[model samples]
Target: MRYALMTLIAVSLAGCTRAPAPVADVVAVVSASLPSDPADAAWNAAPEHVAKLLLQDLVEPRLQAVSTPDVRVRAFTAGQEIALRLEWPDATINDLPAAGRFNDACAVQVPLKPAAAVPDPQMGMAGNGVAISFWRADWQATVKGRGDTIREIYPNALIDHYPFDAPSLEKGSAAQQKMATEYAPAEGAGNRRGGARTTAVEDLIAEGPGTLHPAPAAISRGSGVRTPTGWAVVITRPLPDGLSPTSPSQIAFAVWEGSKQESGARKMRTGWIPISIREDQP
Candidate 1:
């Protein structure tokens, strides 16, 4: 009976001391500067992590099927900032947005405040918020000198006379500008997506499912390029508030395949994954 009691206690202690599940961290190597180009050789120094993606079906407008199964991620840090390079297989390129046409895009999501417990990976919870740096292939094309004009987007498109282009209205005149604004209502309303963009990335914040909004300050930058077999992208942004060389944080990812009609909430996503920053090797 005594031996049985001892065995029971030992078994209980063994259960208590069992090792926790291994965590795969996206380790960020120290660098002098963050790379904005996806093809930069600096990314080679960083270790790659393959994150498995799951279809987003928790809410309405969910993705009914999986198109992108995973994403390959590498990261580096320049003290104040960090950059992540993501690569995924994609056979086609879709960078132009039109009626019934979507743009291929990817996003990185991190908690606004790092803590032991993270916010919901599906954006966030009520009070907890997540900062997202979104990169679109179309935006990258625009930043790389693709004109946003309708004529550029649709070279074969035919247009009738535009009121703003009327001969009577002087160029740059208030009346002409007003007429132009009337025609481009979205641009007139200060919608950034409707006008020419200097950067290929947008910083956004979200709380819960339908509370996404543009971040007050736009500080992130990114670049994307087409590879022979897929798309490679680099997203650089300020480091999260509590990330440090010895400390670890979490990150999540979402990908949209325009070819598969994926947009908005219809996409593939990953849960929060651990991230660690390490000192540069000598």
Candidate 2:
């Protein structure tokens, strides 16, 4: 669901001054811009068929909601189990039970058991409607300098949210999968890349100690975890939409280990993306 613009900044450049930034500052900004090699300017530019490249520096992505196919969730729960067998539609994505999750939210739950008989046409049945793929990521940036502890917080911003992308079920188009075992398909293509590509930092943080100003390995001043490696810079002017760790666009994504896009996975073409996941669930 794309958000409505809050305000429009109409700036007419009557007079502009381009001052040279500090050498260190310039290097840092340039480094952030290049997730690949510093020499590669190809980062962030879209492919030929792609009209424009909406580059994004993703932080983390999580599944919010999913669309179920051929089931009426509300009707099923409300209806009494008359013990009559009814035919189920082709697919069902139940909201399984979650420990810390709110009860108000629908999740997959344990199947109601009785005599443990096979689902026969003579037994009662219910299902949720067309499934949904709620793919989302919270793109973020950190604020540094002054009293603004780079460890404390980011002075970054995020994009306008939009509706979940609904892929057509028309067969022979595209397929998406999740990292969890239960979500595996009977047959599919490609190895498990897992969700989206997340940024890496541990090594980059180590790289910082010998180069430029270095920060602590691990510092906890308040509620957030701060590792010094300069900033894991990701361009955020435009973010890839609709893809999650599950349904991420198959094009290209950058993975940041600790501070920079090094250490794990492939090097980013340029630009930061929220493709990878932190074990703590970013």
Candidate 3:
């Protein structure tokens, strides 16, 4: 059935000269920078080519585990090509087998909502050299099928690398950091709104043990990166049962440093989704 569905989609899409694509919702912290043309407009509206590129390059490979998809990706875009984000919802993990953390490790009861994950800058035949932030927080978790061999071999199991990134730092261990780096962004450090305009910002790529980060990212002081000061995310995990003042379900986020050992590094103060986030036809 899954193969047939993908086949059907491929055939259907193949027959079309032009297909609707995914659109990215651009939320500008500084107004007046938003794209104006229909061709350039961010989320809720975008060209088909953008969506097609994402499906071909990123989405498809990540979606092999999905048995059925309710929402189809529509488009993608960014002033800063460095960080490209694709928007869509995935609830399939809720259907995976669960046997309470042994071998047949089932996913947490929480369903995955519409979310985006960062595609590797190295994905293309030519790697895009820059730091790309896909799901700034919660959505960063890795998703995929464990396959029959792995599942059969380890029935009452904890699917290795099961929960992607946790909202709390304490929840993710050194092992998780090593595994999460498999999906973490390239260690470029700093958001490039475009080729130019490198706002001075303090950023860190936390990895394992002491503020786990991947590669060491160098930022010149006069380079003008946005200076978001003093943060040290130790790890990423979901909000503990009740901790955040804002919606407790929010994804943890940071551009600089990481959660620290000081206190509450493992807690989410708010939920992640915002009104400007995009939604596709489901």
**lDDT by residue for model 1 (1-282), tens:** 999999999999987634222226688888888887788876766778889999998789999988999998988899699999999999989989888999999999999897668999998988889999999989888888888678777898898888899999999999998998888877788776745688889999999888999999998888899988889999999999788997889999999999998989999999999898978542
Q: Count the backbone clashes (under 3 Å) in each candidate.
A: 0, 52, 47
Q: Which structure among the candidates has the greatest TM-score?
A: 1
| Higher-scoring candidate on lDDT, 1 or 2 | 1
lDDT of each: 0.87, 0.19, 0.25
How displaced is residue 41 in candidate 2, in Å? 7.1
Tell me the deviation in Å of residue 150 in model 1.
Answer: 2.1
lDDT head-to-head 2 vs 3, winner:
3
After superposing candidate 1 on the true structure, give the runs of residues whose Cα lies further than 4 Å from its correct spot. 1-23, 172-175
At residue 53, give the lDDT of candidate 2.
17
TM-score of each candidate? Answer: 0.88, 0.14, 0.22
**Prediction 2 TM-score vs. true:** 0.14
How close to the true structure is residue 231 of candidate 2, measured as C-alpha lDDT?
18
For candidate 2, write residues 126-170 as lDDT tens digits.
421111111111111111112312222334534343122224332
Q: Give the TM-score of candidate 3.
A: 0.22
Evaluate model 1: give its lDDT: 0.87
Off by over 4 Å in 2: 1-62, 66-282
In terms of lDDT, the best-performing candidate is 1
